[model samples]
Structures are given as structure tokens and as C-alpha cells.
Target: MEKTPSACAMQWNIELERDLRSKKPGKSIEAILDIGPRLEWWSRESNLHAAEYKIFGLIPGEDKLFANAILLRLADAFKSGDKHMKICIVKIFLSELKQRRQLRGQGRKDEGILSKDKVDSYRELLTRIKIVFDSGNIEERALALVLFGCWAHIAKDSADVRYLILSSLWSMHILEAKASLFAAGCISELADDFAHVFLEMLGGLLVSSETSRTIRLAGGRAFAKMWCPILLADIAHKTGVNLILESSEEEFSLVMLVSLSKIASKWTPLIPRQVELLSSFMTKDRGLSLQVIALKCLRFILTKGMYHFPANSNVTLKLFGVINQLDFPPALHFDALRVLCKILPPNLDTIPCTEILTIFSKFLQIVEFKLQSPVISERVFAIHVLACIFDKLLGILKDRSGIGSIVSSRMLTFTFDRISY
Candidate 1:
């Protein structure tokens, strides 16, 4: 006779219980691997709910067993298991940690807080995981870092636990490790006292000549997330104008530029200066890739600090110059159009109708030209830019019969012509 799905679940549950109860670390690891796949199965298989009741009940409440048996053996499993098995173990840790957090949130102190016996087991597990992080393969080390992050809440109250996590940030240099640590820092909301330390470390990695390109980029991203006014000012002063003018390393400069772009919203005082620097870079015969980045940084600045650039500002004209230049690539053209759209003042009343009309007229002419291009991508890009312009200025343009009628006629002719073809 064939077994029902329920029967299969029951058998696996029995085997899992036996494995969890076993003294050998390998058996406990096998049980953890088994539970990984069945987690979704147990949740979705309504018929197997009764069978799942015991295992679910066993796993969360048996913190001592988990800390001692399962977590202690994870280092070995991470070392020996294939990618799938290693992923399964990490999933199990995350699930259990989540449950512990939920229980603590609900005031179940007895279950959430470890007892004396379980405390020792938990400490041992941390030690073992740290060992894996210190000596394991790249994937293993990354996984270990994730586990440390999940446990960062515990570090809030325990000095030892806090030290272990902070120390791991220095020891792990891989990009993945850095990303994991930064994310964990965000979640843990590291105390202000330690924030500077973390920022300093990330800054060192970003500026260090010895750092690989990938690590440097990751470090830049990390620094952006942890940025504050004081730190930003410090970095800006230290790098000074040399960041744009004298930095011979293109990749490093690009990373710094991109990072600064993200924090534009927070640092309003520097917007005008950055606008001038990036505008100069774009107008020059710089690398196409660098120009694209500079355009994007300008876009971010305009989006965050639009009030700083009046319609007649030199910055606005510089942007127009970028758009009108025939030699620039379509990609730069598209991004410049985006920046222009962002430059439109939120309140139309602040700028005169003629000034706005002049801007729209220029935009409409560009769209009309690009819409007629033989290349499909250029035409598509033109359509997108047209949509963005209309989306931003549609209300203001509607009141101006001359430009509005021109826009309507151009769009209708383009649409019908394409359909007829």
C-alpha cells in the first residue's frame, strides 16, 4: 500500500525528532537540513498540521538543545555541506531567531530569555560561529556574519556579545561581509558612541589604496548609509577639491561621486558647489561612464535642492548646454532631460509664465526632433523624455495655448503615423 502525504510527514517528523534527540552532532545537523525543506511543506500542507505541531513545539521551546546541538554543529555543516545545505542551516537560525524576538515582544520572558544552562550553550554557539567566520570559506564566512547580525539584539545588553559583532566588522573584509555588517548595524541601531567608529572604519576602506574596487564601492555605499553632517564635513574637508580635480584613480573618484550623490538630500549646503563641480565635469571631454554618473549626481541634487536653482541660474543654463550639445550620447541626453524635469519649480507661481514657456518650448523642440529619429532606441528614449516633461509641466503647459497646442499636435501626428506604418 502506498503511504498518504500525512503518513510521509509523520514518518519524517518521527525521524526528525529522533535525530534532534540524538547525541551526535552530525545527526542533529541532518535533522536541521531535513526541517529546512519541510518548513514550507508543513505550513502549506493543511493535512499535516497535526504532525507539524510536535516538531514546531519542540524546536522553539527547546532553546537549550538548539544552542547546544544544532548551532554548535552548524560550523561543521557550513564547512562540509553543499550550498543548499548551508543555506538551509542559515534559514533555520533566522526562523528561530525571529520566533524568539516575537515571543519576547509578547512578554514571554521565560521562553525568550535563556536560562543559566542555555546561556552557556548560547555563548558556546557564538564562539563556534565566530570561529567559522574567522576561518571558514567565503560563503561560510558570509553566512556566519548573517547569523551575527540576527543575534545583534542580544548584543544590545551584553558587552561581550557587542564586542564580538563589532570586532567581526574589522576582521571580515569581503564585500559581502561588509554589506551584511552594515545592514546589521542599521537594524541594531548601534549606539551613537560607536557610530563614529563604524563610520571611520568604512571611510578607511573606501579611501584605502590597497582596497579592491568592489570592496571600495561597497564601502562607499556603507558610508553613505551611516553618514552624518559632522562626518560628511570631515570627509569633504579631508578629500577637498582633490576628490574631483586631482584623484587619478577613476574608479575611486566615481565611487565617491556616487556616494555623495546619495547624501545630497541631507547636506543641502554643499548642493551648489557640487552642482558647479559636476556641471564642469559633464561639459568637459571626460569618460562617457563618468559623465553619466555626474549627470545622475546632478539629477539627485536637483531633486533634493531644486529651490537653490532659479530658472535664470547659471546652473540651469549649464544643464541646457548639456542637453543642446550634439556630441553627447543619447544616454547622457536622457539623464540630462531627467535633471531638467526635476529643475522645474514645484510651484508654477514662483517662476514667470514666459520663463516656463521658454523652457517647455525648448523641451518640445528636442522631443519633436528625437521622436523622428530612425533608431528605435532614440525614438523610445524621446518618448520617455516627453512623458516625463508632460508629467511634470502638463498643468502649467495646458494654460498656455501656444505651447500646449504644439505639444498636442506633435504627439497626435507621431502616434497616428506610427500606427499607419
Candidate 2:
């Protein structure tokens, strides 16, 4: 339970802000750091006020003393501070939270006089922050939630903070997207009460064309980068996959596909599902960005061998059409070709050996055209992809006797006509 701010604490809050602002250089504010954490009226108001300023007024430094002193009374200030003052307190606490994370990252122990009994103290401080967060106005609540998400990496009591985060994220305020992404990254311990609502909200944002593109993309990115990993942490695979599949917008789906490919590398069963779903977006009509991302994700999934891709003639032919089209960006062109290469040894009945050779032959003509262009990278990328096709093609021609004469004869004629270009 959190303590309500007493009248004396409110008075000290004023004095503290004032004294720190007025404190002159070389004045010993050490007395402020020495004041015990207890909020007692017996202590002179002027002294606590001076201490408060002394601790907060100084710029943060490597030394933990000032940070520790401020944290000691921070919860009290949070309970009593006015709106602006509360924001200031939130800033200081968040800064300390960042420093704590940095210390852990550096492999340094939490070292300071006040930090000797750190766990209990920091936990209590976070509890106070949570109390303030629950009771603050919109701006205050959003800011406090951001602070919690920022510390999501190290906070042990995150389960307590998760629902509040979900509420803020659900509001879709300008602040919600960022705070949600941060929380999604940090709050791996989120409860299903929070996760269920959050996934639903993200799904709606991602699927809705009415939602701002920025927010939609952020939702997709957050789900893949942060939410998927966390939900999958405890075997909640269906929840994450379902949300992604439920989205309707092309951009949102593309963003989610890219995110899923990055995180789902170890989750093999998901690869084909992602590939199959993303294949629809690899069409001539999809936006270049969506097409590129979808194809890239498909390529990534196949290259990683995350799943055994059984051949689908319809999907294979669609990819072939995307490859055959000239309107998509060159990178996407390469990605589409790469996807074809990855799903090689396709079931011949579905994606026939002859059809594969024909695609590669046309693919060569595309590359040969690029080689004469000024963009050296595209030329180089195209040549590299073309080379890979030939290498793969040669092996296929050698292994199978049925299409050897026709494919080899056509390959020779195509090579003679375009290889020098």
C-alpha cells in the first residue's frame, strides 16, 4: 500500500524545490543527503528543502550519491509534488532507472551508501511511482508509464505495472504508440489480462487502413519485435500468430511479416505459414515497400531453412509472375528471385523443371539489362543473383535427364545472346 502525502510533506515539497533553485555554489548541500528518509515534521522544513534542491539541482554525474539522496525522498515528493513538480520527480526517477540499467549492462555492482540495501528500496520506489501513475492526470499517467516501460528490462515487479501500460496503449493517444512499443520490448512478464487486450488493440491498429500509417507500422513492428517473443516465452504461440494473421492492411501485414521473420528464426513451424501468408503480397499490384518487405521476409524464411516448404504450384507460379514483372524495385526483384532459389527442388509436377528453367532464362535477360545500367550496386546484385541461378540451374540440368536437352540448348542460346551484354 502507498502512503498519502501528508500536509507536512507538501510543505517540504515547496521548500525543497525553492532551496535547490536558490542554492549558491560551494554551499554544503551534504546536509540534505544526510537527512534520513523518514518524512517527519520534527526536521526543519528549510533543511529538507535545501537538501532536495541540492540533490536534484546538480547535473547527474558518475557518482551515485546525489541520485541516491534524491531517490530516498522521491516517493514522498511524488506523493506531494504539484503537477510540474511531479513531472520533475518522474524525470529524476527515470534517469536513475536508466543509470541502474547502464550499471547492470556494464557489469558493475550497484555501489553507493544508500544503495547498500538496494532491492527493497528500489522496489518501494517503483511502487510509489506506480501509485502516482495510477492517480495522475493524462500527461502524468502517460509519462509515468513511459518510465515504467523504459525500466521494463530490470524491474522485477513488472506484472504489477503491465495492466496500467495496457490501458495507456489502448487509449491510442499520440503517446500510446511509443509507450506501447517500449513496453512491448521490456514487459516480457506481462499477464494475459494485459497481453490479450494489447494484442487485440495492436491487431485492430495494424489491420485498419483508417489508422495513421505511422501508428499502424509501429504496432506491427512492436508485435513482431517485442510481443511475439514474450508471448512465445510461455508457449502462447497462437496468441501472437493469430494477431498477425488477423490484420488486413498490406503495409501493416508487411511490417509484421518482416518483424516475424526476424524473431521467429528459431520457431521452425511458423516459417511456412509466414511464407504462405506473405506470398499474396508479393504481387505486382502491392506497394513497392510492401512487396519488397514481403519478398525479403520470404527469402529470409527460406534461407534460414526455418521450415520445410512443401511446394504449392499456385503460390510458386504467383512468385514466378512477380519475378517476371519488371515494375517492382530491383531489390525486390532480387528478393523474389532469391525466394525462388530457396524453394528450389520444387515438386516438379507443381512447379515443373522446365518452368523453373524458363524463369531463370528470363531472369538472365533482366540481369543482363541491369548490367548495362549506371547503378553499379544493382548491376552487381543482379549479376550475383544471375550467377546463383546458373549454378543452381546447371546442377538441376545434370541431375534430371528429362529436360536436359531442351533446357541446356535454350540456356546456351540465351547465354550466347545476353551473357556479353
Candidate 3:
């Protein structure tokens, strides 16, 4: 039911950008905290232009306001089972983003907002959202909880608030209210949608043996609380929509992956159960996808436990089956080898030289892809692992294989090679 945007709103946005960014004193990032929600609600009512910017301009700067807008619109969509509203909201955001970029080209400092101020704003906004979770209609509450998880990763103040909200939903069993969302005589198509993501995230963050045990205990304890059973399995599980590829934004995914990887040690044992129950997802073409997820999980496990871990070598070998079974594009192969290089004892598996060269032949793609991080710290992980191989390569080839060693050098000359068809 979203309407088309008026010329005025479009112009207002442009003016707002110009007014805020062109100043010497600078604009308050908190001023427009709620604009994202307002624009979204209006866009869902039918502004095609509003709808476009609703998603486009709104997503990056949304903070708490963005979450509110999403919650409100999702509630509305749930009540009406309206597809147009979803489409409208997304379109508006995208369109707004497109417009913002156009304006940026002409000199506008996008929200000029500092991350700290925005996180502070989101905390207050989260308080308001919790009230909605308890009293706003059930569908609205459920939808709010879903968004809580999505925004939790990005929102600076989001950690504790996100966990509590999701925990409260679990303890309360909001999904059991059974209000039932239906559009075409079917039950609500809306589901937790964010649960799998948070779960995967939780899995990724488990880094240490101590954290691993704690996470399983925490996950089990959390899920074990069952005031109601058949209708659910702790925290409102999204029974309706089959979750597949719902989350894939590059920047966001990377953020979630890295953070979760930090906590991956806690998630390992908890994963088998999640993987087992969600058996339907184990399809044909998805083999590669699953392997990627598994290896990434394993990589996360090693990265976290590497320092303090006592059984580092055994953990590597036990998980070796998972890594070796994985089917990555040749691009990822080198890092897989590099990861192995981190834990592989010089005397155990294959000769260090042959292993280094063999993996270097394959894993250069990982090196090339990972080398682009602008942050000195972020690039360090790859460099450190690649260093292990380079040390061995240098020793073996400094006298024997100088040409081969240069190809594997830090310059990453391999990076410029595009995979042309």
C-alpha cells in the first residue's frame, strides 16, 4: 500500500543533507535517529520514491530508528500479510540510498554521524523496542525480536541489550501466543528469520576450550528452558519460512563472521545439534556452501584457541577431516593450507617444503583476496599465517628455488590476476 513519494520529501532529504554536512560546527547525529522509522512507515503506506529511499538511504544510518522502522513496518506487514509493504519499504530504502549517493557526489557528508553517538542512541531506542515486545501486538513483538538480533551485531551498545531481549522472548515464549499470521489461508510466513544467523554467530564466537564449554552449557541451558514444547524449541523458532540465503550482505556478513569467529570456541559442540535438526537444508548444490561454513567455523576455532590451547595439534587433526572434506574454490585452498601450516608439526604430516609449495600453488587466491584490508591489524592474520609458509619457502628455495619463492613473496603479485572467462 506504499504511495509514491512527493517531490517535496525528495527535495527535503537533499536539503537536509546539504544543511547538515556543509557546516563547520557539525550536525548532531542523534537528531535524525527516528527519521528512518518514520520514512519507512510512510513508504510502506505507498510512496514509491519514499519506499526506494526507505531501504536505500535508511539501512546504513538507521541505528535504533532503523530498527524501529523495521519493527513497525514488519508488524504492519504481519497484521495485513502485505507483500507490497515489504517491497515498498525495501525499494524506498534503496532509492533513498541511490539519491544519497547522487547527493554525496555533489558534496554531502552522509549523516556525518559518529559511530559512538549512534550506538548511544540505539541503546535508548532499544528500551522503547522492549516495551513494544511486551505489549504491542504479538506479531509486532516477534518481528521486533527478529530485528533486534539483526541490529545487535551492528549496534555498538547492542550486545547486552540484544541478548536480554532475545532471552526474554525465549523465557516468555512470545511465539506461543499463537496469534497466527495468515495471508492466503496459510499461517504466518514470517518467522524468527534471524535465529539461524545469531546461532551461527554464536557458533563462530567460540574461541577457547573454556569458552566452548561455557557456550554449550549456555546454549543448552538457554534452550532447555521449556514452558511449552511441541509448539516450539526454546526462543521462538521460525517454523514458517524456510531460511535460505536470507542473509548475504558482504560487509555485514564479514563483520558478523569475524565477531562470531572470536567466539567460535564456545559454539563447536552446539553446532552438531543445530545441523542435525535443520536436516532439510542439506541439499545437492549446497554441499560447497556447507563446507565453506564448516571450514570457516574450524578456522574460527583454531584462530581463537591457537594461543592458549593445549591440544592444538590434536584439535587440528580431529578437525582435519572437516577441512580436508571441504571443497573450496582454488582461491581458498592456500589459506586452508596456511591454516594447517599454523598447527602442523614439522615432523608429522607431509614434508614442510612440499606441503608449503603444494598449498602455495592452490591457496594464493586466499592471500590475494585477504590482502586488501586497509586496517594494519586486520591484514595481520593473513600475513602471520602466510609468514609460516614463507619462512619455510625461503629456507627451502633461497638457494634452490628462488623463482618459485618470489611468486610466493609478500608483494602478492598474484593479486592482479583476474579470473577472466
Candidate 4:
């Protein structure tokens, strides 16, 4: 004479409502969940219900405890190798919330407006982890990441935007999905910690080689979005070794690196990290065949001037060392000339033995015939760098012989020929 599990859940929901209305303090989630005899079978559905309750009032507040509780539950699901549970939480709950909002429109007829239950659910989440950030521990860090990932919005004045997002600096996912969502009023919550957890999961995947493809690709896309923007302008830069190592296809590696360069273009300062990562693809990993793509991106990032991308002597010199060892597609040499213009100190062309300028000078004419008109986009890029090199070369025309002479003769003639309308 056992009650069916759904029947029991219905009963518990009734009792829980009674407890909530009575405003009782002793009511505990554990005690309620334990009410069923075969709790294991009912636990999954019950856990979902706990997460979905809307308890918080508007002017939503941060909750650390609830956030932790949710994360712990999710982590447990992951630990148990429960794919259905993981997909349910990540795809159905976390990701699908945003998707629902997209369908619902601002008024939310599609998914319906946030209910009292939904608001309270979020409030509980924020309240639990509220003060732990200042406490300083790995748990706190994890707590911060979860809250940030789950709810922190980037909208400037929205009631939901909890943190000042420097995410455009380091998070690609934020830039692509979150930025647009925040701006359009489509999304008001962000779990900023997804990147950290994702990175942690990725490292685990790298070690175990058993992680799902969904996890790897989604995780990488997430990291690439957030971290890409931050590495620009030379503050605390590091090479993107992940691109070369994680991406099996050389072309995919190139596409990713090129995408990084495109993001770096609007930089508030010079881009040194771009060079470090780009150098990894140079010469040796032709299979990492992104030079043309990377060059196009580099050209765009450097549209303004050589001064835009300030040099890291270490990265630039390493790049030169790599350049010295082998030959590349002549198109790459041309693009390298453009990158060198920005990163090198003003008179780097004067460096003896093997500066970029020397390579260009010794071989500029040699490769001239091979450097065909780039594709329309490529032509646009080459134009941008040509403008930069032309400006700088004009200044030192008297001191620099080969480049200035070639520019005076062949390049200026082309500009005039193309523009005479």
C-alpha cells in the first residue's frame, strides 16, 4: 500500500506550501526530500522542483548558499556520470532559459514573464553565496564564478547587472552572447563563473580524454569568447597555446587564432598577446594553416598605425627567430612586415643581420611578383597596412634606403593608378 512517487511529490508540494504559508523556520529541504520511502527514485525530480521555486522579491539580491547548493547538486550529478541529469540542468534549465526568453519577447508571452516563483528562486541563489567572495578561499572563488555565470548581467544600469564586466577583456562567450543579450534586454542574468568551471572541466577532459564532445566544443567556445577580448593591449599577456594544442585540425586552429586577432582590433592599447599566439603557428605548423587568415585579422587590428600594437621584445624577437628558421608563403612575409611595423620600436628597420625590415628589403622585390592582388577582403587589409607602413616610411625616407625607394617607385604609383577617378 505504497503511495505512487508522483502522488507523494504532489503531497509534499502541498505540505511544503502549508509550511511556507505558516512561515515556519524549521522547514528543511532534506527533511522534506526524505519523506519518501524509496527516496532514490524520486530524488531527481524533487531536486529539479527545489531549483525552480521563485522565492526572491524584485530588486533581486545575490544569494551564495542557494547558488552553492545548486552547484553542489550539479557537481554530484556530474560525479555520478549521469548524462541525463547533466543535460537536463545545463541545456534544459541553464541554456534553455535564455532561449525561452528569446522566444517570449520583452513582454514574455512566449515563456511568460518571470513568475514570483522564478524571482524568489533567483533571490535564494544570490542570498546564499552573498558574502563569501570577501572570505577568500577556493570555495569562495567557485561561489563567485557560479553566481557570476548564473546571474551577473553586463547591462550598465539594469537592476540585474551586479558586476562591472571586464569580461570583454577575457571572455568571448560574454562578448558574443552575453553582450548582445544584455544590450537587447534579452538576458538580464549571467553566470560569470561558467568560464572557470568550464576551464576546470576542460583540464579534466584533457587529462581523462573521456569528456563529451559537447563539453569540449561548448567549453572551448565559451572560453574563447570571454578570454579573447581581455588579452589585448598588452596588459598581462600570454600566448594562446590552447589553440595549437586543443584544436586537432590545423585549419580550425587558424580560424580560432584569426578570430582572436579580429577581437583585438578595437583594442584600447597595443596587442602583444596576439603576436605570441600567432608566432606559434608560424612556419612549423603549416597544418596550423592560419597565416593568411591570421594576416587578414592582424592587418585589420593594425588598421590605425604601427604604434597601435606596441612591442614585447620577447615575443617579437621570438617571432623573428622563428621567421629566421624557415620560409613561409610569401603572403605571410608581407603580413609579417605589417605586424612588425606596429610592434617593433620606431627604427627596428635599422636592425642589422636579420630584422623584419631587412627581410622585406632583401626580398621585397623578390616576392613582389608573387604577391598577387589579395581577395577583396585581403585587398582591404593590405590597403590598411600599406597606409601604416607608408606613413612611417615617409618619415624615415632619407635614412631607410630600400623600403623608401621601393615605396617611392612602385607603391605610390599603384595608389595613384587605383584612385585616379
Task: Judge candidate 1 at residue 283 and give its lDDT.
Answer: 55
> Each candidate's lDDT (Cα)?
0.58, 0.56, 0.38, 0.41
278: Cα error in model 1, Å: 5.3
* Clash statistics: count for each candidate: 0, 2, 40, 41
Task: Residues 1-421, candidate 1: write the lDDT tens digits.
Answer: 4333333544565666677567785776678866654443332332323445465443333433433343345545555566666677777757755665565545555432223433445666566666766777677767766766555543344455456556555454674456355544543343444555566565555556676666655655554444355554446424433544656767766776766665554566655556666766675567666776888788776655443554344555566767777777766777776676566545443566666566656666777666766778877776776676666556767677786776667666766876787
Local accuracy of candidate 3 as per-residue lDDT tens digits, 184-280: 0010111233344334433333222333333333332232211122233322222111122243332322233323333323444433333222222
- TM-scores of the models, in the order given: 0.56, 0.61, 0.30, 0.40
Q: Identify the superior model by TM-score, candidate 1 or candidate 4.
A: 1
Best prediction by TM-score? 2
lDDT of 1: 0.58
Worst 10-residue lDDT window, candidate 3: 179-188
**Per-candidate RMSD, Å:** 8.6, 11.3, 16.8, 15.7
Model 3 ranges off by over 4 Å:
1-136, 146-168, 171-260, 264-294, 300-335, 344-421
For candidate 2, what is the total of clashing residue pairs?
A: 2
Q: On a 0 to 1 TM-score scale, where does candidate 2 land against the true structure?
A: 0.61
Indicate which candidate wins on lDDT.
1
Candidate 2 structure quality by residue, lDDT tens digits, 38-122 = 2221211212233343454432231233333345465555555566655565455455445554665466553323233323456
Show pairs that collide, candidate 1: none
